[model samples]
Target: MHELKISIITVCYNAESTIERCIQSVINQYYSNIEYIIIDGGSSDATTGIIDRYKGQIQRVVSEPDKGMYDAMNKGIAMATGQVVGMLNADDVFTDNSVAGTIAAAFAENGNDILYADLNYLKPNGNVLRKWRSGQYRTGMFNKGWMPPHPTFYCKRSLYDRFGIYSLDFGTAADYELMLRFIHVKKASVFYLARVVVNMNTGGVSNNSYLGRIKVLFLDLKAMYKHDVQLPPIALLYKRLSKIRQFF
Candidate 1:
């Protein structure tokens, strides 16, 4: 069987502590056809040095000052030469090498343009904090306050070429806005795999503080309004409670 090449990008800034594990996860993938790119937003720490250690394995490594995370990601998207592109944070990793292969198989089976899977949240000490089960993507799911866990999602390069880059205006919800713009506004076709593909460390910037969650909710509301999409207030209540269930 011909290998399906997937371009995986990781954006980082002062992530020396977790960058190594993330790079290794992609470099050591059993799937040989991968274009791995890492973009460092002028890290003051040892993050660039860590990325250099694996220079031989990476397809492209860009280290420079950028406007923000999304800016760095746009560079990665431009440099990628693979058919499929997946973004994995510096603190997240694929569950195993077969994960990419499995995603490609689904694409081949149905020719869907976008693919997504479930994810788990881990603590700093590598303990499981919660399991984030991102259910299948169906029409009206967004109206029900449903979204694909961004970290575990992958898209064909063509999708980005058509829809464009993430809006730098949205801080944490840039991924959310991009999803809505593509899936809701443009009506892109998608597929969901009911499997955990990635493990992301908790305490990320978006949910590290009470204020952050409040800000996220505000941005989420703004994102929906821009697309003329409305989710019942009760749906947001249910989503919050469902997230709480993951911890137990």
Candidate 2:
């Protein structure tokens, strides 16, 4: 079996507390051909120092100012040399050491352009707050508020090379925009892993404040229009309402 190299990117800014866990998760992956990259958005804290301590394990590190999260992610993606690439936020970690191995096997077996799994959101005390289960992909799922967890979304490097990277214009919805562009518009081949792949700490930018949620909604609408998804208004409604299930 040809072991395909997988690059996992972690983007951070002032995330000193949880960055170590993220780094360890990537380092502990069972898959041998893993390249871990970190992109820091000029954090004026101990985040850079913490990352430095793990420099021996990480393949590449970039500490600089960027437009926002999406911009930082674009930088990491650009630097990645792996056949498959994925992102893990500074406040997130892979579910287990086998994640990388499982992903590699899935890619080898299915040869899909993209592979996405489930994810869990945990409180500060490590209690499960929300469980986001991405079942499978369908023709019109995007319109029904179906989106794979961004942290669990892994795609071949060529997909980004062809469909493009995350756009900064969409604000917190950049990931959503990129997924919509690739899956709904470009019609990329995708496979579902049907397993929880990552654990995200609660209180991310999109859900931290009401204002942030509003901004995300506006940007999501813009993304739907930009990608020419039919019935955007209904899709936006479905997107907002679909989150109700995650809490249960």
Candidate 3:
């Protein structure tokens, strides 16, 4: 069997303090056939210098001005040349060195178009803040406000070519919209690995402020309606309520 090539993209802006951990996690992956790409939003910080330090290890680095995180991710996706593509944010790290290897094995055995696992949110002191357990996916789960963690999501490159990339208009909720479009609308085959794949540090844009959460809520509703989801109000409610369990 031919070895599957996996592309992991990390998108960032002004992430000088935390970028190295993210890079190191990918570099330390046990899987050898991995392509690592970093997309910087023209950060006016030590981020560029930090990225330069790992130039030899990274396959490609694009440092330029982008509209936002989602735009940077789109740029990274376009540059990817691997069969499977996954995104890891600047503040996220793989749980262990075997993440890529485990993902590759699942893809090889299941032949699923999309693969996702669970994740952990860590505090600044490296303590677990929340445990996001994305259970197995089933048909109609999207309507029930179920979504896999974005950092743990790995999809075949062809799925992006078919269903399209993230939408900028959704703001912080673009990832939710893309998942709903692909899993719910396009009916892509998905497999869930019941293990933690990534550990994300606290303080994401979506949950950073009350205003940000409101924007995310409205954008999420828009995404569901745009994708023809039934009873979006109920789904939105369930989505908001679902996060409460992650805290405990």
Candidate 4:
């Protein structure tokens, strides 16, 4: 059971400022069988340089231009050779080193197809801006604006084989669309790990500005429509409202 191979992928494009910490967190994991793969989007900055410094520890490194983060994620998925797969973004860090092993044990023991947990949204100075507690997942939760923190979500590689990888159609909300498709649409099995597993940086593309939020809403509505989601306007409202709890 301890021998289950888990693939961890990190996608970056000119993320030199924070990529090193992200890489360090993955390499520091005590999990014996982590296949660490880095997908670089032909960064013109020193991002590739920092990655190069860890060449011996990293399993696979692909430096080239890609469509976007989702496209890069698909490339990493294709390159993964593990029984379970998860992603850690360039600007994100695991809450602790044990996170990888904890995830592996959960999969190796419980036999869940999808697993996710809590997260902390951190400001630039490393202050906690919000605490994302993904307490539980139930049918119809998505309509009420509920979903797992994607950074901590891990699943069997076979799930992607069955359902499909991230879709580019959703734009910045592809992660949201993918979750809606897999858990809600296909009804895959999931487990909640309870513990906080990731510390994500604030100010992602979607919430970066008012205009950005509007664009994401348009894309999200389109995704909800494709999945036959009910009361999308209300769902979107619920989704935004739910985030308020994170700041408390």
lDDT tens string, model 4, 105-144? Answer: 8887788899999999998999999999998898989888
**TM-score, per-candidate, Cα-based:** 0.95, 0.98, 0.98, 0.98
Count residue pairs with overlapping backbones in model 2: 0
What is each predicted model's overall lDDT from 0 to 1? 0.86, 0.92, 0.94, 0.92
lDDT of 4: 0.92
Report the lDDT of model 3 for residue 222: 98
Which pairs of residues collide in model 2?
none
Q: Give the higher-lDDT candidate: 2 or 3.
A: 3
Q: Residues 18-93, candidate 1: write the lDDT tens digits.
A: 9999999998888788999999999999999999999999989999899887888889999999989989999999
Question: How large an RMSD does model 4 have?
Answer: 0.9
Q: How many backbone clashes does candidate 3 have?
A: 0
Better of 1 and 3 by lDDT: 3
How far in Å is the alpha carbon of 57 misplaced in model 3?
0.6
lDDT of 2: 0.92
Q: In candidate 3, which residue pairs clash?
A: none
**Residue ranges of candidate 2 with Cα displaced over 4 Å:** none
Distance from true location, Cα of 63 in model 4, Å: 0.9
Better of 1 and 2 by lDDT: 2
